[model samples]
Target: MAIPRPGGGATQVLDRSARTPGRRETESALALAERMPRLILESRRVSSTLAHGIHGRRRAGPGESFWQFRPFVAGEAAARIDWRRSARDDRLYVREREWEATHNIWFWIDRSASMGFSSHLAQGPKVERALVLGFALADALVEGGERTGLLGLTRATASRRIVETMAQALVADDKGQDDDAPPPATPGRFDEAVLISDFLSPPEAVKASVDRLAGRGTRGHLVMIVDPVEETFPFSGQAVLHDLESKLSLNVGDAGAWGEAYRVRIAAHRDRLAEIARTQGWTLTIHRTDRPASEAALRLLTLVAAARGTG
Candidate 1:
């Protein structure tokens, strides 16, 4: 199926062919920024599950709702030491409880060349959709007083003050290049992680990265943004296809002969991803680039709501 173009004057679809003439594509960063507040609000309405899960007002501070107890450390506050428990065990123990202040949300975006694919009928490319979604999510969580951080799989920083900085850096016109690499180890503990990608890489690689994030006890939400062309594998007649990340090319003279095989492969890929998400208890949502950003945002919100047990 083809992606539907965005209607109204809210978004402008850039012409990719124009990039070959040495003219720079006008930056839409400002336009995207301006739409962010509205998107965030809309996201909240759609994603009551996530909004309620993360933003629900809980009792202030480390209270008696059992997180864990640890051996008392030197210079620790005496008030935190559980005297009643200490008397029973004859060993000093400090009550460690879940605190609202420690909750942090980390957002990751994929900036690989594969993410630039967008059908003529679609509103924008995968990368652009991912950026807008990440921005809106971050803005919403931050607005709710949660500490938020941003990371491009190709770039990462953990500063609370620069939540949208990485996304802003990705505003350049699509060059169809794949120079960006995965980020180095990230600093600080993250409570939840949101990953936006096309996931063009092998399933094992994707699963490994996800496992690393999960190892940190971080709940994960993986948003797979794809172009209609990629999902449908629509290559009519003869065509030359290229792997954007590997820089490898394939020429096919008979599109009809390979259509069935291609569909099978795509189905297997999606099934594997779904199995991984199920096993890991992670939320996975797929958005087509041809869909309106508003539609994609609503779907994402629904996923979040489901995660929070609100759906």
Candidate 2:
């Protein structure tokens, strides 16, 4: 995808020899070997920080477990009224059954080139935190008796070896690694989706991807991973802005002055992202790379539970 010339910045094709693929790859085999072990270890550690078994997988529907007994509302449906429970009370009551069923949650973490970005202020690049949070979420969900998998790439699995399985799926993929978003696919009804990305791509494209994945009554979530520099636009004079996805560089003169307008455009972009999620009845959690992964993990867990509860 071509970079939008924000603020009319002058961009040109970068010379191939200056920073070739050999020099630019963040997923170069050596780096993946170093990051994978930590990805697995940190995922388990982060999952351990959150309380387990909270998801009772409960929703109000047809099930064996009794959810609650509520005062029956006047809707003329006497069949739903519990005559036995009503016998003890002046008001008629209705028996509400909790939906007790295992669920499938699929995750998609952006592995595009831009996700490799970082700055001095960030703890690490965006992908590091993305992978950690993704794996951690999968671990937590599996513990809750829900199946989890990599969206569009792997089948849903509740295996005890979830981390290893997820890691292997990513390791085996040698194509479309540079694509900005998850490829479109259809998941089962009542399935949930978790998408982790920087979301720097065009909003229209992102919206389309969300629309497709959320089809068939599937609910989704958006985890926007950001770096400190992207948040603050801390560039100065005589700077070169490189499009990590496209490998095109822009000579935006006086970047310090460009910060204000840049910030405005970015803010608008983020607003669009939030709007997309809101319209779809989905949730959005913004996770900065510098913050604790546990914080986002906990927030996301709560969201998944809330979605099931209210769904």
Candidate 3:
């Protein structure tokens, strides 16, 4: 199945049909890399949908702090012309300000095994949604003059080259070396972080990861990507459940009988994550694959703007 065009309804799904032998049914990392162009385009398309929702940063250009005065060029805004400076010079003069650039905003995408699961009830794999959301947010962030990079794979940068760099990293990230834990190095105090993941790891593990960043004075945003089936647990009758990362298997007598308990556990897990965010003074937003990627991307940008005191 092909990825649905932007604005397509919830039923639209990402194609995961191609796979190498011995690999899971989900789209392999190589297949995903081959489709990077399409993914980036789709991400930009989704971002454009929400672009109108965000206002341009008022102080995005040169800093408001005064620097020097230069002769005003023709057709310049009258307000930009400094009357005091012009009075002392034969030509019109304009006040210039010191340039103030924003700090790097790091994005961490979870490539854990569970993130690759796409239930028949949902749109696509959690990882796909996360990548789209990350790229969409990166587009907006870069457009807004903020530098961005993947947390573990790349450093913060404002160069447009980082986009392709990130895509390459995402496609090559299927080696399974990294777990759901946070990156080892903490971000600088001035830098901001955005973490997108299914966050299916143990609650303690998740807390430890976030706490490590928090300890370093890093204020981050936690974006939880969820599959519709994961949240609803809609399976019924007898079914075998398998762990994506660990190959552990379980025989369920009746999935329906386990739904309520499963939901409760999931809800508790979410609550713990929320509490962790609160304790760290960070923000948390949950995005489901069944929903529009733009929704999450927009919210993530808003959080980024707010964190950087730009919005």
Summing lDDT over every window of 10 consecutive residues in candidate 2, give the lowest-scoring window. Answer: 1-10
Write one digit per residue (lDDT tens) for candidate 2, span 1-311.
Answer: 11223322112223334555322544442255567988899989998887663466633355447777878754324666799999996989877554423357889988777677666677877778999999988888767756688877887765557888888888777664666778776778788999998887778888888888776788999999887667777656655655655555666668788777878887888888899999888888898888999999989988998887766
| CA lDDT, candidate 1, residue 245 | 42
- Which is the leading candidate under lDDT? 2
State every prediction's TM-score relative to the real structure: 0.63, 0.79, 0.77
Q: After superposition, how far is residue 33 of candidate 2 from its true place, in Å?
A: 3.8
Question: What lDDT is obtained when candidate 1 is compared to the true structure?
Answer: 0.54
Candidate models: Cα lDDT each: 0.54, 0.73, 0.68
**What digit string (tens of lDDT, one per residue) describes model 1 on residues 1-311?**
21111110011122234332111221232234554455445434443434443444234544326687778755334665799888888789866555423556677677655555556666765656777677666655544444456543322222322333544454442331332323444534536677787765667767777777767666678787877765656656765544444434455677666665666776787677777676777777888777755565556545543443321
**TM-score quality measure for candidate 3:** 0.77
Give the count of colliding residue pairs in each prediction: 2, 0, 0
Clashing pairs in 3: none
lDDT order of candidates, top first: 2, 3, 1
